[model samples]
Target: MRAVSLVPSLSEAVARTAPGVLVGVTDWCTHPAALDAVRVGGTKNPRVELIASLAPDLVIANEEENRAPDLQALRAAGAEVLVTEVRDVPQAFRELARVLDACGVRARPRWLDEAEETWAALPVPDDRLRAVVPIWRRPWMVLGRDTFAGDVLARLGVTPVHADHPDRYPRVPLEELRECGAELVVLPDEPYRFTADDGPEAFPGLPCALVSGRHLTWYGPSLGEAPRVLGRALRAARR
Candidate 1:
């Protein structure tokens, strides 16, 4: 079965679970370090015609990471597309299984099982810290409402300040974010690449936890270690 993955996490999941199945992937699908699939541009602006030319049996994508028009175009070009929606950990696991199954994988991948077990074994936090999670600077877009990253952090005892916002990802002023009464600022290393030197400085006195974006945001194999890695980072930042 020839498959093309537009979402990075799904790409890694498929690559690890069923090697040699993915014929094309987006430029941002960087896991496995040595993935040998054809580059199909970025997720948002994937080369649809180029992808269609590959004549893959199936194309994988996400509701948030990929554009609707692109998926429509793929279908119009006679390509089968499977789109996934993952808002929380449970949904992520379910969707992962669904995508793999669609790719003709009968046996559930060991990593998927490990990730489920790891999350299930995590003890719920007694105290949750309120935080503002910035996915990007400049325009200052933050994690708001229902989001996979926000849910992941919530599991690790960090609650996003804008989780109740009307928009999923809202653009807020830096000053507003600073004054949101959040005790912590959670920054991930992707979509913005927030670092110890770069992002924490903007939050002033608030504790800034620089977490791995892949572990925090991506819902593939990284989910297995997200609890420990994010918990450790949050603990250190609060110290």
Candidate 2:
């Protein structure tokens, strides 16, 4: 069946759904690597006319990633639209399942299983591990409570300075870092690769360090080896 997907994560899901049937995908959708077969529409603002002309069986979209109008247009044009929301691992798994269901892909995806075990088995240090996860800087955003980033840190027994609230990535004031009750500042590499040089200089008095954003953050199969990597980092941070 021909399919078009909106985001990278769902693109992976769709590939798992129908191994070689994906015929159209957003520029941002890159997983299964086979999606190279699909014609390109911009990731966010895909050229609807081009995609609709393909006459795909269905289109997949992530609520978090796809712009509303594009999805609505796909639906209006007679494409069956499936919107997925994968904030945490479980949700991600379900979303993958749904996409595979749509694509007639068989069995669960490997990344989901590995990600679950990794989150469950990660060990916490005997003492409280305080940390700050900054996803972006210069109009800084942080990995706060109840997010994939927060879940990852929780696996390591670390607590983010941000409160456990509705906002997963709240743009906080620079001064708030000092008062957040955190000992370590984690700078994620992608989206904004924060380096040692870009360290505590922004907030003068924090124990800040650069971290692998993908390992500690990016959910899905990529999450498999992250715990081990993070464990070593936490231990080294302890040293």
Candidate 3:
């Protein structure tokens, strides 16, 4: 089966589970750095014409990472598109299995199973910290309601300060974020590339944890080590 993936995490999952199935992938699908698929542009603005030209049996995408019009255009061009919605860890696992199954892999991949086991075995955190988790800087957008990254942090005992906001990713003034009374500030290295020299200074007195965006945001093989990796960073920052 020939498949094209627009989402980075899904692309990596398909590439790892069924090696030769991916015929095209978005430019941001960087995992398995040696992936040999036709470059189909960025996720938010994929080259629909180029993708349809590949004549893939199926195209994979995500609700949040991909735009609706692009998916509609692909379907109009006679391409089959499978859209996934993953708001938390359990949903991520379910969607991963579903996507792989759609790609003709009836048996579950071992990495998927290992990922589940790894998350399940994590010991409960002794303390929970309220954090303001930023995904982008310039305008200062943050993780708000029901995001996969927020859920990932929740499992590790780091809750986002804006998790109850109506918008999933809310744009707030930097001044507001600083005075939000959060116990910690978590910065990721993707969608924005926040680093020690950049994001930490914004919240002067609060502890800031610089985490991997792939492990914190992506919902594929990276799930296996997210708990340990994110946990360690959070612990170190608290120290």
* lDDT of every predicted structure (CA atoms): 0.94, 0.71, 0.94
TM-score pick, better of 2 and 3: 3
lDDT of 3 by residue, 72-190 (tens): 99999999999999999999999999999999998998899999999888778788999999999888999999999999999899889999999999999999999998999999999
The estimated TM-scores of all candidates read 0.98, 0.82, 0.98
Could you list the CA RMSD of all candidates, in the order they appear? 0.7, 2.9, 0.8
Off by over 4 Å in 3: none
Clashes of each: 0, 0, 0
Instruction: Residues 1-239, candidate 2: write the lDDT tens digits.
Output: 88877666566655654567778877755566655655557657888888888898888777766789988888888888888776665665566667777787667766667667766665555776678778787788887667766766765777787847468688987778667777887776765878777755775665665667666655545667777787677767656
Pick out the ten consecutive residues of candidate 3 with the lowest summed lDDT: 118-127
Question: How far out, in Å, is residue 198 in model 1?
Answer: 1.5
Roughly what TM-score does model 1 have, to 2 decimal places? 0.98
lDDT value, candidate 2, whole model = 0.71
